[model samples]
Target: MPRTTGIRALIRPLRQALRRRISRWITRCCGTPHPRTGPLPAPGRILVCQSNSRLGNTLLLIPLLQGLADRYPHARIDVVIKGCVHGSLLQSLPGIGHVHELPARGAAPRAMLKLIRELRRLHYDLAVEANSLSTTNRILLAGCGASHRLGFAGPDQCLRLTHAVALPSVASHSALQLLHLLTALPGRAPASQPTLAVYPDAPTRARAETRLRRALGSIPANRPVIGFFTRATGNKQLPNAWWQQWRAALHAGGDPPLLIEIVPPGGLPVHADQAAVSTTDLMELAALLARLDVFVSADCGPMHLAAAAGIPVVGLFRATPASRFAPLGNDCISLDEPLHPVVVARETVWRYDRRRDTRRSA
Candidate 1:
C-alpha cells in the first residue's frame, strides 16, 4: 500500500503533463485560419492573450495596452488572462474594454471549453499572443479564431500566426519587448517607451496617503523616506543578514534616511521592523509605495510595482537577468550579479539625494 501510494504521487505530475500536452494539441488544431501577409486590418474588437498572473507581468502589459489604445482610439480591447482577481487588477486601466478569465493549462476541461465558447461568440478583428514564449498564449491566440493573429513566433507558433514576429536574440526589458509587438502591425508603429503603470483610484490614493503619514510620523520636507522590501519569491531574495549589512552601510554616513520596511500579507520576518506596514492589495501596495522617496527590493514584482508607481527603484538581481525583468523607467537602477550590499545602499542614497536636490531646485 505504501509503495502504491508513493507511485501514485510520483505519477500525478506525469498525468498532469500528459493532460496539458493533449489540451495544447487540441487548441492548436482549432480556429479558422486567415493568414495575412501585409499591414493588419483596422481592428474593431481586439483580444490580447497574456495569461501570466504575476504583478510584474500585469504592469509590464500596460505599455502594450496603452499602445493598442493609442493606435486604435475606438477599438474595444479585451484581455485574456489567468486569475479571477486579475480582472480587478486591470479595472479602470485605460483602453481595456473587457477582461476574460481562462482556466490555467492542465485545469478542468469543462471550464476551458466554456471560456472558449464565450470567446467564439464574439467576432474579433485580431487576437494577439503577448508573450513570445508562451505556448498556451499561442494556443489561445490561434484557437480563438480571429481573422488576424499576431505573436513573436518560434518554430511551433510561426505557421499559426498571421503576423508572426521574430523573437529578439538579445536580452531586453520585458515591458519593452511587449511594446515592440506593435511594430509588427501595419501602419505607423507606436513609439517605444516605458509605460509600466498602475492607477490607484483617487480615494484609494488619498487613503494610502493618510496611512503613510501616520506610519511615517513627522519628517523634514527634504528628507527622503526609503522603503525596503525584505521578501521576494525564489532565489532572488536577499538574505536577512545582507539587509542588515545594507542598513548598516546606509547609516554609516551618520545621516540615516527614514527606512520603512514593507511587509507582505502572511507575517513579518525577524529582519522586518516592528512598525512595518503590511498590505495584500496590489494597487494599495502601489499607492503606499508611491509615497516613498526611494524603494529597494530584490528582482521581485514589487520592484516593478514601485517603478510603475513612478518612484526610483533599486532592483537587486541575483538569479534573474536584470536586462530582461528590470524595472523600466527613468531613475530606476537594475543591478545584476556580484552585487555588493554596501554598493546598493550607496546607490540608493545617491538617487534619493539627487531627487531631493532636484525638488529643491524646482
Candidate 2:
C-alpha cells in the first residue's frame, strides 16, 4: 500500500506538469495579438476559470465573480467550470451570463481537445485564473488566450501569463487570494464584499422544500433551522461539532424553536421535523442552502455556499485555520473548536436576531 501510495503521489506531480504544459501551449495558440503600444482594452467578454474539483473549493471563486461584476457591471461573465459544478454553481451568481462546462472528469485527450476547441471559439477578451494557484489551474487559465491572462506567480510556476498577482501569505483565505487576480486590473478594489446571487424560482423552491420534507417529515417553519454537516471524512468535513451541540442546547433553551438538518456518514436519512439535502452537486447544495435560515458546517465548500446564499453560516474550523476560510458575509457566523459553548450560543443568537432584523427592515 505504501509503495502504491508513493507511486500515486509521484504520478500526480507528473500529471500536473503535463497538464500545465498543455494548458500553456493552448493559451499561447489561442492568444490574440494586440499592440503593446496602448492600454488594455475594456473587457468585452471575460472568462473566469473555476475548474477545481471540490464543491466548497469552487465556491471560493464567488468573490472573484462578484468583484468582476462590480467593476465591469456590463461585461458578460463566462465561467469555465467542471460539469458537476457548472449548472448548479454559476447559475446563481449575479454577473455569470454563461457557464461553459468542462467535460473532463474522465477521458483525457478527447476532453482536453473539446475544451480547447470550445474556448478557441469563444475568443474571450480577458481570462482570470480564479481557481487555485496550483500549476495545473494556472496553466489552464493561461491556455484560454484571453487578452489579459491573470494568475499568481509561484516559484516554479511555468504557465507564463502577462498579468499576475503575488500569492498572499499563508494567513489569507483562499477565497481572498482568488480575488487577487482582480487586483492586477486597474480601477478595481479587492475590499468589495463577496456576493453570490441565489434567486431560486417558485418551482425550484417548492421542489427543494418537498424533497426536504420527504426526508425529514414534519419540520416546523416557525422553528429556527440549524443545519449540521459532519461528513468531513474528506474535504467536506467541518470541525464545529461542539457548536452544533451548543446550537442544540440553545434551541432547547428557546420556545418552540430548533429544527436541525442532519447530514451524516450514511447520507441524509429520512426523519421528521427537519430537511435533509444530500448531493455531490455544488449548485443544488447552494440552492438548498439559500432556503436555510442558518447553516452550521465544517470549514468546507458548503459553508461558503451557505454564506454566499446570504444565510447565516456557523463554520466550525479544524486543522485548517478559521481565519483563512471563514464565511464572507455579515450573516455568516464562524466558531473555532475548544471554544466555550456560551460564546457559540451567544454568537448564533446574535446573528440569528440580526438576520431577523435585517429581514424586518427590508
Candidate 3:
C-alpha cells in the first residue's frame, strides 16, 4: 500500500529540483510566460491540469468546474485528464469545451511527448494546476504554456505558480482547496456553496428510469428506496456479512427500507435479498442513483456520484477520512463503525419520513 504522506515527503526535494529544471526548459520551449500583473480581462481559453487518476477525484473536481463556469461564463474550459475511462467523465458538463485525455500517469515516453506537442500547438489565456500537492500536475501546468498560470503555492514552487494563492489556514477538503485556487484571480471569489455536481440529460434520465422500473417491478407511491454499494478499494471494502448485519438491524427496527445494491466498478451484482443494478455509463448510474430516496456506501466514487445526483447519502468511513471526501450536500452524513445499525435505521427512517419506509410518500 502506498503511504502517501511518506512518499510525498521523500519526493519533495526531487520535485523542487525537477521544477527548477522544467522552469528553465519551459522558458526556452514556450518562451517566457507573462506574469499576471495588469488589469485582467476575461479569459477565452483556459486549461486545467488535474490528472490524478481516480473516479473520486474526477467527481470531486465538479466544484471547481462549477466555479469556473460561473465566474467566466463565456470562457472555454478544457480539462487534461489522465486515465482512459475518465476522459469522458466531464466531457458533457456545461461550459466545458473539451476533455484532453492524457494516457494514465507513467505512460509511454512517445505518447507523453506527443501530448506535449499537441498542447503547445494551442495558445491559452490561462492555465491552472488544480492540485496542491503534485509535481506532475505542476509540470503539466508549466508545459501548457498559457499566458497566465495559477496554482496553490507550496514551499519553493514559485517557478510554476507565478500567480499562486496560499492554502487556507484551516484544513479543508481537496474539492474546496481546488475552488480556493480560483479565488486568487483578481476580482474573483469562490462559489458561496460548492457541491459536486453532474447533469444527466433527459434521454439519459428516461433510459435510467426504464431500467430501474424493470428491476423495481412496481413503483409504489409511498416507499423509501435505500441504495447500498458493497465494494470499495483495498481496506475500504466492506464484507457481505457486515452488510447483512446492518440490514438485519434495520429489519429489526420494523418497516425496513427497500435495499438495492448499487454496484461499484469491478463489482458484480451482490447475491442477496436485494435488487441489483450495474452499468458502465456513469451518467446512467447517476440518474439511477438520483431516483432513489437515499444512498449508502463506503467512501467511494459512487458515493460522491450519489451526492452529485442530489440524493441523500449516508457514507461509511472506515479506511478513509470523511473530512476530505465525505458526501457534501443536503441530508448527507458520514459515519464510522461500529455503527449501531438500529440507531442508523431509526435516524434514516425518521429523516426521510420513512414511516415503515415506502417508495417516497407521494
Question: What's the C-alpha lDDT at position 95 in model 2?
Answer: 73
Cα lDDT tens digits for candidate 3, 64-172 = 8878878889999998877656655587677898888776656787886777777777788888887656656766776777888887654435344446677765447
Ranking by lDDT: 1, 3, 2
> TM-score ranking from best to worst?
1, 3, 2
Local lDDT at 136 for model 2: 44
Best by lDDT: 1
Please give the RMSD of candidate 1 to the true structure.
4.3
lDDT of 2 at 160: 53
Better of 2 and 3 by TM-score: 3
Worst 10 residues of 3 by lDDT: 30-39
The local distance difference test score of each candidate is 0.78, 0.65, 0.76
What's model 1's lDDT at 50? 88
TM-score of 2: 0.78
Say which candidate scores most in TM-score.
Answer: 1
Tell me the TM-score of model 3.
0.85
